[model samples]
Target chain A: MAILDPTTAPRRSQLNQRHVSSHALFKELGSNLVVSHYGDNDSIIEEHSQAQTLAICDLSTLPRIGFKGAGAPSWVEAQKLNLPAMANTTVLQGSGSLVAKLSDQEILVLSDIFAQSKDVFHLSEQAKIYHKNYDKQVYSLPRDDSHCWLAVSGTLASEMFSKICGVDLRTHKFSHSHIAQTSVAKTNAVVIRNDLGSTPVFYVLSDISGVEFLWDCLLDAMQEYGGYAVGVSALQRLTKEH
Target chain B: MKLLTCPLNGKRNISEFTYGGEYHAMPDHLTSSPRDWAEHVFFHDNVAGIVTEWWCHTASSFWFLAERNTITDEVIRTFKADEIYQQRVEFTAVASETQS
Candidate 1:
């Protein structure tokens, strides 16, 4: 296949320059371009192995949206989306997206790793539709532009996090449903655990402007464990039958 | 590293919070003089004893009240802003009246 240009996408990741520098191969994911694989690196099989041990992937271009305000919880529940009983916990919608409550009023929704789920888009549309009814007080927060999403996966992923984060994120300490809103590498980030089948995967959402620094920081810390960047294709394999 | 407990997010590294100045009862917006407003916005008591102050959790932007001793720099307790600010305070611009 011919090398695709990320620049062609209307929406692009903030780390596009860094990815381009690292020989990243572009692929379309939900109207945005993401790194399918870093060209000149190991094949997807090798990348899959690297991911099982320690790997970082930029998911900045994936589908994600946030809602906040007094009426958000009820409004979300009205859409038939199952919500976690408490804040700082996440639950998978039977339709496939993940919903994470940041507070009593705020929640963030992310698409399935396969990028096949349209739950986020539907929620976004719902918010727009009901926005005319000011009674709901639910406000839409389009996170795709405001925040960058990155996923760190592997058996040693939690160990790698300790190097930069102040919070204890060990698998024994922080479970898959837990969320940590704290300082990481001196930058504020919302950390959510959503493992890939058996392997642990933590999703970090931070200010988009600071994403480049965070990305570089994660890559630098993971170097000691021979961690490398992988693509979505490799991550998908982790969730399926091996 | 110092640790600060956020009323909403629970305990977190002190670095995760931004001190939003001392919490003070707001003078009635329509009744207070310009000087009173200026003092309320700019001047802090800087008390040496325990005092309530405004703090924001940087990651979640959760604003809450914290009682801390200024001299010792120890936080006594943290609680949600709703404890005191139950009603919304609206500031409407009187543009039409002022246009004259």
Candidate 2:
């Protein structure tokens, strides 16, 4: 008997074939595949274009995990995890990952660059240690499949968000590493202010099932701002620039 | 839209929190009768004056204690439940050590 390879299984993002343009280029990321670029391989045009307008990119493939229960804070502390002490705040860890303290008892861990790397697996294993030690007091909630993530960036990003969100997300008000759980386009979403590149960026996480609907709604809102979709290649380039 | 101050999340829209009703002491389950347990679980004083209650922020799932005036629907203060519980435990430990 042989173990099954999860990567070989058919896996697609919520946007999948529906959002891919005629000239889009696709690539595999872990078990799932997503659009690497809308058309250009270098993403130079996309990067330059986004400098003035807004760009929305799907990040559903990123690794995300949730820690909850009364003992979560202590458990995280015992693991020597560097997280913000206050709730609803996100801190960028030494590894370039994010540890968001949603509440005293709940936290969300996200990694953009090392989702498929051994570092992420190490973090997961460390979490398991606490889970085993505090069996009844802590619970782990894997969110890779439960939420659809989008990275919206550029100068006009805030303007585009204003159309869908009620909160004041201007840089002065929201600031860096601030997290808000509010309605976006009439759907509940968690908006985290973590800029990508030199431009302002927000990572929006919403229910996985409602991703397509939310994406369509966001695209419609982006149209007026002359916003367009960028693929993971462009997103990677932006991250590298910063 | 009304806002509620979550001790953890700061001031958030009231819609983000779920009212958990008035807080009351729970009778010791090992000693208390079934009627007492049921009363504690099913009944609330519904007081008009200042009262303490539990509230949960839906997004972060953070639960905290809120002191409010039912008559005015005004929140007086909010605090974390864990901090209060930890204080009580420490107090009990200190008292026990002194007695011993």
Candidate 3:
């Protein structure tokens, strides 16, 4: 069945379109990547760059915001630390705990139920006020299209990615905390760190119009991994499959 | 990329950091020196020479007590957080040491 394709229509007031729920968003993206929405801006597709993995998502169809400065961590921690305020040079630990709650000035603890909590708006406001004394700014933007996530692992995955997507993965030049909006085949994806260390997280975000095209590109890239495209059911049933 | 050169580490990206604010923004509530407090709180010389500043190395997870030249943005000496200040001693001891 065809998903909601918005690229072709390009409506003027598109930010008002429906949102992809956290359950469906995570369920659809599979297990390779942990998924969650931040604030009312759901368009953000941020994930830990662990190993040689790729996390694809339909976040373009959501909303997003950017917060920068020294107080960024403190402000973010004011509510929850699920997203630890690591140095711009660092990345989150792989599989340790993807979810976090911001408890104090310098602490972010892993929280179990913080993900589904609906009080993000209230918390964000308080954090923003606290941020005023320090140099911090947050930018919230809603996306106009749906996003898709793909997490690819293994040694050759980087080489495969370089072939599928024209990006320079030469370790010294590009490392973690670096992001670029580039092309993967004919589609657009923001390729980031696939490894929490120096590896890269190949985040491919495209409009629904390019879904089929991206899917084909991914299959070709993963052909050597015995990688077959799987749905949420198959992803959830991986433990059983193994 | 606003670059700040650490006297110890040479030049590096500014992203691996946490701004420590003006040279001395110590809270007024802690110390009561109507004159000393005024100078520390409101009066900043903005000198060009080496200055002591607090810099949290977010990447290294360490706080740096750096001697930075504010005008050139050159960090002269960088030390660990603990090394920035001496171990806590009684006020009398500090006064005696200064006198001696």
**Leading candidate by DockQ:** 1
Q: Which pairs of residues collide in model 1? A: none
* lDDT of the candidates, in the order given: 0.88, 0.75, 0.41
Task: Name the runs in model 1 displaced over 4 angstroms.
Answer: A1-3, A40-42, B94-100
Q: Candidate 1 vs candidate 3: which has greater TM-score?
A: 1
Query: Candidate 2: which stretches are off by over 4 Å?
Result: A1-10, A20-24, A30-32, A39-44, A70-81, A114-117, A129-134, B87-100
Docking category of candidate 3: incorrect
Question: C-alpha displacement of A42 in model 2, angstroms?
Answer: 7.4
Docking class of 2: acceptable
RMSD of each: 2.1, 6.7, 13.8
lDDT of 2 by residue, B1-88 (tens): 9988888767877877898987887677667899999999999988889999999977666679999998898999999887556632
Candidate 1 lDDT over residue span A1-242, tens digit each: 56778878887788888888888887777676778888754677888888899999999889999999888898888988888999999998876789999998898999988788898889988887798776646889999889999999999999988999989999999998899998778888999999887888899999999998999999999999999888887788889843
Q: Is candidate 1 or candidate 2 better by DockQ?
A: 1
Tens-digit lDDT string for candidate 3 (A35-121): 233222232222222122432323332222234333545455455434634322223433332222111122221111112322333
Clash pairs (backbone) in predicted model 2: none
